[model samples]
Structure formats: structure tokens, C-alpha cells
Target: MVAYDGTDFSGFQVQPDQVTIQGEIEAALHRLTGETIQISGSGRTDAGVHARGQVFHFDTKSGIPLDKWRFVLNNQLPDSIVIRSVEEVSSEFHARFDVKVKEYRYCIDNGAVPDVFRHRYADHIRSPLDVEAMRQAARHLVGRHDFTSFCSAKTVVEDKVRTVYDVRVESEGQVIWVICRGNGFLYNMVRIIVGTLVEVGQGKRHPDELRTILLGRNRELAGKTAPAKGLTMWEVSYEE
Candidate 1:
């Protein structure tokens, strides 16, 4: 398992002339084993997003003990990224394909003034939100649907159907969190959902309108994509 502050990354993928999570790990692997390695991540998070439970798998011939891999990698990695754990898995296991569920969290600082400490981790929204309205809007998204309206227009995936198992809106003091758990998600889907919910909270859109937007299947029908800094990949799960 890995956790990273993605603010400095171009994205999770390896890109020429760009710093990325995969690139950094592959470089570390090369330094440690003298062999180039490529990793497959559970998802390719966009720039500025964070991950507390991102997962990746790579093939290696080195004799490094599984328990010691985490320490070895962390020693070589930048402070922004950490290897939380390492374990041997079946040769047949695939990180991206074996995923059974993914959880994402979007944080909002609803204080009258943005918290300086959380500027990079949370979205600061000064307007008082109607939590109940946001909850109602979120409920409409908790099911199987074609999320074309919520995903980015730049998305290349032709199939947009995915199951959102749950959506919860919770608050603590000045922070409001929108938690989403699903079997899968389209690119930019979670952020757009949060944006639409925020609109509902702000009384600019009705809670019931989410259904209509989903049915419309037009990206323009949904609200703006929420800023990436507020989002985090909280967890990923797989079948035992």
C-alpha cells in the first residue's frame, strides 16, 4: 500500500519530462535492484489529488524480503510519498484489474475564512451549505448509472456505466466531507458529483435535478468539476 500527497505530481502515470508517482517509484526500484520496473496503479489520479491508500503492483526478481520492501522503498522515496506496507501476492494478482471497490473522500472547509494549514488538502467554500440538501442530492447518485454527465468531456472511456454503492455527507466543526464508495468510477466522476452536490447545497440546484442530469447524459448539464486538491483516494479493496 502507498499514501502520497499528489500536489507535486503530474498524475499517477509515467510521463516524459513530468514528475509522477509511478515515475518516482520506478526510479527508486531501478536504484535498488539495478533493473527497470513498471507499476500498475489501481487508478491514475489527476494532478493535485491525494491518496492515502493507493495500490500498485510490480514484478521483480530481487530476493528482498516482503516485510523489508516498505522500509527500503521509503528510504529512497521523497517525503511526499510513503510505502505503508508490502506483501507478496499471487502471481495472478493484478492491482488494477482485481479491484472490487474504491473509496474517495472530498473535503470542504466551510469556515468564514479558509484554514491556512488545510489550504492544500481541502477546498475552502465560504458560503454556508445546507447539509441536508447536499445529502438529498447525493442520494440520487447512489446506484448504477451512465455517468457521462459527471465525467469530463476529455474522458476517452466509451462505457460510462458504474455502480456507486454509497455516498455520505458528514461534518466536523468547519470541515464537511463527502465520502463516496463505488465498484468503479469514470474519470472526473467523483469531483463532478461533489460539484453538483455543492450547487444543491447552495440552493442553485434542486436535489431531484441530479436524476434529470444523469438521464440527460450530457457533461454540460452537470455542475463544475470541484477543485482537485479537495479530493483523496481514501481506500481500495479487493476480493480475498
Candidate 2:
């Protein structure tokens, strides 16, 4: 599956009575295939979290030819979601387990006032942010460590150690984009990281303080969780 704005939907997962993206997509798949199939996604994005290149997989006994899979699925799916491509692979291929890395991008609009058009897509900050300071702080996060401080308290994962491959911050006009690539992320991890970086940009926290936060491994010592609307899953990769 490709990415979506996810603003109009409840969330990525199917719920009892809510209009979720996954529920709609799976319903469409059932309409086309006449099979009650279960889809597995790389991650379960929150209600407002968006994605540009999300991936999912499902099994079918319909025996539809691989070349025609996209055509069939697209016809039944809504306009909000698009099936970019389809291919046949071994049944053992798991979308989440085979994923080698995931990348996310957070957008911040640094202007005196917010734009109505971008309200649903980017975060608007009234105060001026020090871009250089944020960039320096971002560098400190690009390494392997136990990121307990950056994650939300609701995360149930047993292991907190994760490797961050890269972090880049750039500004264009009033928009600042923070891009991060990692092996895996804990719940609300990227949003908290961005929140901390924003504090660093505002001179409320020092760049080196990230090390202390990580060492402390205490969620209370971290910055507040950034809004989910500004975060987008940029891409996902799997190893051969």
C-alpha cells in the first residue's frame, strides 16, 4: 500500500465502529477478492499521523494474476488510498519483520501566524526557532542508544535500544523539515524527539542535554510530545 494523509480517517487500524483507513481498505479488498483477508502493516500510525510510503501485505486464495492485482485493488479502494504496485512473493514474507528501516519526516511552520491551508499538514510555531541550534541537536540523536526518554509512556515494547542512522534538518521559507531514519521506533518516539529539538531551538535546553536525557531513561525528563499531524512516515525499506 502507498501513503495517505489520514486526516479524514479515524486511524490506520480497524476499530469496532469507527471509519478507519485500514477498515475501509480491507473492506474494499474483500469486495474485490470475495475473501476475508487480514492485512498486516509495517506500523500502526496514530489517528492523525500521515504517511508517504507505507507498506502492507495480505494473503488471498483468489489466485488473481500478479499483473492484474493492482488494477483490481485500485478499482475497489477509495480515492484517499492508492495501491502503487503489487508483486508475488513467498508466503513467508512479512511486511513488518522484513522491514529493515523506516524513515519519518516532521514539518514545522515557523511564522508569526499559521496558514489555514497548511493547518492539517504542518505544525505552526509563532516564535522564531534557531535552525542552527536544532540542526546541531539533531546530530546528537543520530546514533545507537536506548531511547526510553524519547518514547511515550504507553509503549509496551520490551527492548528500548534502537539505532538511528541519520537525522537531517533543513529550512525552506517558513517550513522546517526534520528527517530521521532508524531501524525501529518506539511509540511516539519521533514526535518527542522533535519536541526536544524545538526546545533546543528555543534555547530552553542545551544540545548536549539529549545525552543526559537518554542516560536518565526517564520519560518525565523529555520534552512534550509534538502534535501527530505534523509527523509523516516518509518511507519503508526491507532487506532481500
Candidate number achieving the greatest lDDT relative to the actual structure: 1
lDDT of 2 by residue, 1-240 (tens): 576787888888999988887898889888887889889988888888888888898888887888998888888877777778786768999888889999999999998988778798899988999989998888878899999999998889989999999988889888899899999999999999999999998999998888899889989989989999999998999962
* Best model number under TM-score: 1
Candidate 2 pairs with clashing backbones: none
Residue 204 of model 1, lDDT score: 100
- RMSD of every candidate to native, in Å, equals 0.9, 1.5
Q: Please, what is the whole-model Cα lDDT of each candidate in the order they appear?
A: 0.94, 0.88
Q: List candidate 1 stretches off by more than 4 Å.
A: none
As for candidate 1, its clashing pairs are none
Instruction: Provide the TM-score for each candidate, comma-separated.
Output: 0.98, 0.95
Local lDDT at 95 for model 2: 84
Q: What is the lDDT of residue 197 in candidate 2?
A: 93
Candidate 2 — which residues are off by over 4 angstroms?
none
